[model samples]
Target chain A: MSGAAEQAPVLQVRDLQAHFRTHYFGVNREVRAVDGVSFDVNRNEIYGLAGESSSGKTTLIKTIAGLLKPPLEMVGGSARFSFLPDWDAVGRAPPEVVRAIRWRHLSYIMQGSMNVLNPLRRIKHSFRDFAWRHLGGSKAEFDLRAAAHLERVKLDPSVLAAYPHELSGGMRQRVTIALATICKPEFIIADEPTTALDVVVQKDVLGMIRTIQQEMGSSVLFITHDMGVHAALTDRLGIMYAGRLVEDGETPEIFARPLHPYTRHLIGSLPRIGDTEQREGLEGTPPNLATPPPGCRFHPRCPLAMSVCTTTVPAMIETLSGHRVACHAVNPGMAA
Target chain B: MSALLDLDRVSKSFSRGGLFSTRRVAAVKEVSFALEADKPEIFTVIGESGSGKSTLARMILGIHTPSSGQVRLGGRDVTTYDRRAFMAEVQPIFQNPFEAFNPLKQLDRYLFMTAERFGGASGKTAAEEQADVALRQVGLSLAEIRGRFPHELSGGQLQRVAIARALVAKPRLIIADEPVSMVDASLRMSIVNLFGRLRDELGLSIVYITHDLATAYYISDRLIIMQKGVVVEQGPARAVLSAPTHPYSRQLRDAVLTPDSAGAFRAIHSRQAVATPGVSS
Candidate 1:
């Protein structure tokens, strides 16, 4: 993390537009899932991406990770990794090139930990399958290294012998974290890793992630809809709405003074143990990506929406130091 | 003279495998709680996965009979009550609204059926009237949902429709098992707020089963924290949540991440968890 490119971000995503293009009969529909999303994961920092379902958070990550299939196409722009300077996006890169960096330089801690592991195979096989090739080690050496990795996260070494189903949900999550961090990738994509686990286990898993991330000094693009987890785990937080980044800044600052209306609502509406105050849920559903509203996608539901908001898309402006918000009402004069 | 719902040390054990090697798994073990007929309040059952929270909800709903003890609803055993009569008194709001309502079937059918069967609506017009009333209770109109499939409505709207279906029955108690789990974070409050309204306005006692502690504190009047089919803590929601005595309860409380808990990454990175014996082990 601290070398010649120490100042440079590990991952730079710029004006990335990935759409779900579907064609049936005479109709051609393009659902802009990641429309002009731009962000940077700086070296050794946790950048949290927050958004509701269909806000394009998943699409944005998958695009960045180059996990694209049919109907899901990287329409335009680039998500350039520092290691792969020649290539724009992993999606656009050749398979051999893409395959070379996976698990060694880049990895993912997926949401469903159990699904990530083979149901029929022992847990050790997952290690062998995902990390074995990257490490190029003997079976016994890989097993030993995997066991040590598991132990680093405070899991018993015995867990390696058990099947995915045999281990508890929390343990599997820990294993996933260990697996993702084993190679010490410069940047890790953690997609809602703690959302399914119970509060107690969730905290433990989060702590394990923090410890490992700090130890490895790797950048993480942690994505979750839970604001609480964002507040706890991330260094910087970005709020997404309808395939666009609405606001992003330091986690504490965002929590202290949320600039975007949606961010404000998200932070405010969270039910805490001590607070019994009435919190209102936003009206209107998340817009259909296939046919989003004109101008600002959030205008239809934004409580502070004006005529300008309905007509013009808001640019991401630095309202406060390092705090950028995309809202017409927030940045009235700064239309440029 | 009668409690709205009572579970006198009720336990449920599901047998596994065949006769060769039978194993009995106690999903709910010796759990006891009661909601009074005279009072209407949200009584929450909080637990994580495999904690038997769902199993307990089933027993209360009369879907699963307890292996031991009694589940008396309004001074009578839930198993003794006829299915139709029982459903009229207690309605369930499942976790996922998409799965709760048949996607192929129109949303109005559920509301209409509930109206005719449990709501005591005689004619087509009467059923329509009942459905409309229930829909209004959840802040939606029958006209908007009329002839619309489950897919047509959003997750929040479909969940509201499910609630409306529950309301159509005019049930004395509503057993909502993780009702807002599938709904979006932004829309979760609307469904949760609707529960508060149901308690205050409609005077319906709700047994809200969820693992989320924050929401439990927000809506529940009383709550019992469960761990592996055992109640670890039980008291008024505010008192218990604010200062949980049990180790498991304390751990659950401490684990909750909130906006206020945001701290400097370097300074307040990760705290060494205070070890709780017999639990974390």
Candidate 2:
């Protein structure tokens, strides 16, 4: 892990800000979906971003992957990949450049496997549509490469002849992963890949992800709300709250001693088997990002919020060697 | 005392493909279970997507009749009971909160309607009063949900409202199919906890269906594990989960990813690596 960190980061995202601009009739509104997020995915390491729905994790990944359209705009920030260093501005990259880099240098495995694999076509055709152009080979050669890739993911090559609907959910997801990594990209963005899967199949899929990432030495940006998945898979984890990163550290360190109050509540609320001693849910709902509270976005829900917390926004600062947190109560007397 | 709900060798089958090339597929095989009338408990049915858990739930709700066997409520077969009489004794909470209600309508309409239709409330004032009582049982009030639309409320609030709607009829049993799965993690426990409270205080029997083992262990008194429409294991929830005897149940338990089970990933990964020699170390 230390050696992996010593190498240059595969993906560096600095102060990224993505907001949703909605106009209904004449009224204009702005939802700050991803507000000043910064993180780094070290080479060959899995960085997990943990956030509940509408915490802007999906928006952040979409912004990074340059999938943002109108209404959803990347106002500021730079997402630079080691392979595409010349194009520091990922969100604003040219279509040709983005297309050229995709599948060869960067690939994505989204939540719904159906979204990636076409239901009307056979699995092999979907593979051909995605990775065939990226791989410089004839049709027969590409077919061989595709079969070999499916074998790597522990899927039968016979699945290529069947439609997406024919394969089971878990099998289709594995095929999606195989398609994404067919060219052996340098970086992969997996957004809740195994979330739709059952627990039994989820473990196998995650094991495949870890094994494939380690074999290819590709940096993976894994996003899911499940802390259990993060504990088992990720090397480092960043906790997101109200569109802002509240904490970031090694997986075990953050789980053992979470610095931020929100992180503490998030990890503490998880229900485990053999432990049923009246676990309480966090009171109040996540703050609405469109009209978030003043100062800190989470101050209204924070149990230890103080007077200063209402007027001053906390900055993410390093308290331990590599751990960082954004809470005034945790890092008292720290200049805002 | 007679059993409240009795499932005797119930089975459901569905046909696929075109008219000429039709194939029969059994969604749920001969499954049997019963709930006693005097005692209330949480009975859980655990299974994966295609494991026929949903099919069993539909049969219990009378939405789909079993191809074989019978589903009896209070010693009377469910198929013979009238719609109003059956709904008055049994209710359901669906998986997705957003889809359970109409987005354009106020959230309170369903509660008020249920009260009027099933609670013997004729007047608007009487319906409103009954709705308020039911909402109070779920820790909500008529004021908070008076004119609010379904989109205005969060998933947890909407689910609680759904539960309140079910309670308006004073049903003996509630069939919740993955109710909390769509809710946020931080708010999930509150709903699960509410079920526990309902069983204790309100004397409501619930059939909890889910793929999540942890929550199933927390609240269920008895549970059955299903695999591809067949029940592989059934017993006391805590005892069975703590020490599963079936090979499939043990495999499912071992596959569960807990915070403490980080080593399970490495073990599975190495085993997979050996199975597929194509993966370069």
Candidate 3:
């Protein structure tokens, strides 16, 4: 693990900012969805991005994958991947290069299986559509490779003949995973891939993800709102609040001793089976990113908010070894 | 004491397929449970997708009629109750808060309308007053929600408003089908905690339906574990969760990911690998 840490990161995102510039009847609004976020996915590491809806997690991953469109613009900063060094910022890369890099070098497994797999088309056709151009093989060879990939994810080859609706939700998700991993991409972006699955099926699907990642020796940027899932799957976890990463560290460290107030509240709030003790919910809702609270984005809901928290954005500082937190109250300029 | 809500061997079946090739699918099969009238408690139905938990919730709420047996509320057949009276005594909180209300309409309209139609509020002033009271129960004010569209409020706030709308009718029983599932994690506890408060303070019975075992364990007083339209286990929530007797129930419990159980994925992987062989690591 120590040796792996010394190796260069597979994906490095530095001071990234992506904003949604919307115009409703000439009324201008700018929602800073991803504001100065930075992180790195180490080689062969499963880095979890934990946040709720509107926390800019999805937007950040989209920016990283170079999936930006009209209103959602990459305003500043960089998303640098190890494989695509020719492009300084992948989000700003040329369309042809993005198309060339996608599937072969980078792939994504979305939350909803229906989003990836067409409802009308058979599962095999969907696989062919995504992986065919990258695989560069005859139809027969593609079929053989697809079957082998499905087998790896524990799905039978017979599923290729059936429509997406015919299979169970869990089975469809496994097929989606198989489609994403057919190329053995260097960096895989899985956005809440298992959130829609049941507990029993979720365990199996997670196992499949772990197995595939290990076999491919790929880095994964796993995004989900569920802390338990993060705890189970991720090597390192980053907590996103509003549009900023409030805390990030090794999963066990974040779970054991969370430094940021928001991180502490988030980890403390999860309800466990044997523990019947009442857990306190955070006081306020997540700030509206359009006009987010001035200083620290979480100060309004932070229990330890001081006057300084309202006016200045807290800088990400290291509290413990490998644990980085952005909080004025906790990281009072004292290095651990 | 008499039962507040009772399901007596109730079952629901749906017919699907094209003409001349219809197939009958049993969605819920012979599910029986009861909540006592005097003792309001959270009765949770835990199941995965296609486990008939949602079907059972729909049957209890009278959205779908049972093909066999009966669902009785306060010793009265659910099907027999008039729409107004039925809605007054029973309300529903759906899974998706975004879908619960119309995006084009104001959020508080549902609350005021429920108060006027089912809460016995005669005039606009009375309806607004009732709406305000219901919203207060969920820790919101009409002032905050009034005239605001559904898109304006956060998911947690929208769900709370949905609960408030349910409260406006002053329902004896509320059938919540995965109410907190869509809400953010930090706010999920508040909504779950609200259920306990509703049971204690408002004396309202809730039929909480979810696939999540953790929240079910946290809030439910009594629960039934369902699998493929059959009730696999039923008992006090704590007892059933702590030491599940059924094989499926134990599997579900063990699959639940908790913070304390770090590295649980590897354990689950190996165990399932033993059950179904030949999948490469």
lDDT of each: 0.88, 0.88, 0.89
For candidate 1, the TM-score is 0.96
- lDDT per residue, candidate 2, B8-40, as tens digits? 999999998899999999999999999998899
Per-residue CA lDDT of model 3 for A67-103, tens digit only, reads 8997999999899998888776777788888898898
Model 1: CA > 4 A from native: A1-6, B264-281
Docking class of 1: acceptable
User: Which residue pairs in candidate 2 collide?
Assistant: none
Docking class of 2: acceptable
For each candidate in turn, the TM-score is 0.96, 0.96, 0.96
lDDT of 3: 0.89
Deviation in angstroms for A109 in model 2? 0.6
Using Cα atoms, each model's DockQ against the true complex is: 0.42, 0.43, 0.44
Kindly provide the TM-score obtained by chain B of candidate 2 when compared with the true chain B.
0.94
Look at candidate 1 and tell me the lDDT of residue B15: 99
Candidate 2 residue lDDT tens string, A1-336: 556555667789999999999999999999999999988887767899999888999999999988989899999888888777787766678899899988888899989998878889998899889988878689888888899889999998898899998988999999989988998888899999999999989988999998888677677899999888998998889999989998998888998898888888878877777887777777778778888888888888888999888988888899997899988897876644
Ranking the candidates on lDDT from highest down gives 3, 1, 2
Best of the candidates, lDDT: 3
Q: Regarding lDDT, does 2 or 3 come out ahead?
A: 3
Lowest summed lDDT window (length 10), candidate 2 chain B: B272-281
